[model samples]
Target: MDTSLLFWNNIISTCGVPRIITSDRDPKFTSELWTNLYDMLGTKIPFSMAYHPQKDGLSERMIQTMGISLGDHLNKNLLSIHPTAKDVHDMWKKACEKDAKCIAEAKEYNKQRWDKSHKEPDSKEGDQVLVSILNFNNLKGPKKMRDSFLGHFTIIKLIGKNEVEVRLTKDFSRKHPVFPVILIKPYFQTEEYRFPSSKKNPTAPEIVEVEDSPGPVKRIIKASKIRLNGKDQRQYLVRFKNQTADKDKLLAEDAIPDANLHLRRFRASRRTE
Candidate 1:
């Protein structure tokens, strides 16, 4: 029989055709024949994300358990094991219930261990925080024995559960914007520990005018034409190459020379209509 025909025949004859099917994005599952057959049957198929086995963790775990059980049975040389479908189903259900209880107990124990000293941080959005360095094993010099936790970063947003998006304070860093709650601590400002002016956020008006400010003298990005005001007058946009440069500038073609000398010639040559 044809593969498509056999596949549908097995599904309809065995399980009476399921309404929803969850499977990995295997070639067979994504085949035109498989897709067309399911479409005609009005079945919904949800595929696991590519390269992420955790999405099909339940199936993977079951396969692992089956392998273990087969190994144990083979080692023991068990035979004459004949059981009805109902008997096997009952046994599996009982085992699943017992496993669920064990999992619940294990989770409770793990929660207690984590919560013993780890209080829920009262830090809110915009609160300054000290983020713990994940892998800091390079400390050797006497001066290098500084605080393990860097930052005083402002919390930009709270991610799902125990994660926050933070922007580094003081000097800038190219680290990840988001960090787990366990790796963060609320930063309290005191007389001994005043907030550094270098890290302080500028006024809203200044922030709004961020695009107008030119970044470091050394850094300059490619120029793009913004608009054409007159027949010969063109406005070009300048973007700072620096990672810290979030805002870009829109300047007249003539003013490019005064803004940055490096871009003056480049803008003159690469002017688009």
Candidate 2:
């Protein structure tokens, strides 16, 4: 290689000489000639950092990242060979074998994802689920599907096995009663297990992780527990407020008295965080 042009051209290509150059002290890197060239260019030479055993863990992780990237590249190139994948086992044994790393295998994997052939899961009565808004970009629907759940939305009616009637969230309307299963998703948490909040209190709710529904915007989250129903909302459900009281019943009603309960914002509704 013509050392002068090679060195000067690289310097020019980089816009200008950097104040410092950090390099790994490889044979080409640490050569006295390389050091002298940098000195002539008026750039401070910072030697390649020494590798530490603990820091080498990062290097190992980087190598793994590179391997995955290269694997993705090879799989993308392998697309043209997709049709021949199954035949790899019998025809082109070198190319067509089904493997986690094989192009043919990648095509098969992608096919399963895009294929409409698989049966859809049934949403039936008495099943728990999370709800998703099919299109909240609808001027008026529960705004956003309640909590991704909206819960144990018991199927009150069956549209089909894959489609069934579920209970409407209080946020929607009490009179609305039932909603279709298309609004719901399987209520599942990815976490392996949950922890009890207080070991001493067996009756206390377990401390568990639950996913948040995407709100109109990011929510300001807070760490707190809230009860869904109060005495008044319970009364609204039971219809005590709508009862016709007789003279005798009036006395009992006076004794009991009516207490109004407020239900406004939802529990952990919006989060600052």
Candidate 3:
């Protein structure tokens, strides 16, 4: 809150008080002190919806263009030269035009690339869809091995042109229910049997208690010290018995009590080297 107030004060000092203030639903922008100060100044504060940027698209684009122009100027060492007010204005005008043209071209290129693999979403309210897992972090297992999409969530309602309110499961309770159309895909049910003519009763495989009786450590590939929760801890890259190199896992020292013998052997071998 203090930083936001200080920033706004600096902006106001240089540009005078703005009649209207637009911001996102950030905690600092929505704080009581911020609201009270703006209210006293008679400046209307309009907040854009969460996770949506289209509301301030124009301003964002302009800022991006200006940043690109400034970066270009700096890279070319053009800022070192002194120029008249008119010269400065002309240079800025030209830079803005050039940046705008480049931005348009980039946008068109992205649209074409996106269109090749994606189509307009036709999902409606109550339709079951799979939400993209790109933004989620609470999921278990290795990221590369995890499913790219998760759900069977139903669309509750359409928020606007491209956003929708989804009825997500309790697992996603912490996440916002709303998401853009690009992050959702229609869910399709898998067929029980692709080849119906083949009459074969599939037998269920026996469930192994791998966690209860984990395989013995075949060898300790390597060891490393890492900082965990502000403390230094040792970890081992272990390959287990009967498992291939690909099945190797990184484990804390205490995680495999039986691996103490292996750990000692590894340390002794390293000392000899």
lDDT winner: 3
Question: Stretches of candidate 2 above 4 Å error?
Answer: 1-113, 116-118, 135-149, 174-182, 188-273
1-273 in candidate 3: lDDT tens per residue?
A: 565477567876789776655566788778886777676677767676545656775665666689998887654445555435338788899999999999999999999999999787788888989999978978999889998899999999998779999998998888998998988888866543434676568899988875552477888989989999999999999988898888888889888657779888999989999
How many Å off is the CA of 147 in candidate 2? 4.7
Q: Write the per-residue lDDT of candidate 2 for residues 114-146, one digit (tens) a residue.
A: 776755667665766655544323234565444
Q: Estimated TM-score per prediction?
A: 0.33, 0.23, 0.32
- Select the stronger candidate by TM-score from 1 and 2: 1
lDDT of 3 at 248: 85
**Candidate 3 RMSD computed on C-alpha atoms after optimal superposition onto the true structure:** 20.5
**Model 2, residue 182: displacement in angstroms?**
4.6
Over the stretch 1-273, how does candidate 1's per-residue lDDT look in tens digits? 266678778867787776555677889778887778777777767677535666676775676689998887553323345435437668999999999999999999999998997777676799989988664444455645677787778998999878999886534455568888988887877734665554655566644444344654332355444434555544555665463545666566555545557666565656752
Candidate 3 lDDT: 0.81
Model 3 steric clash pairs: none
lDDT per model vs. reference: 0.68, 0.50, 0.81
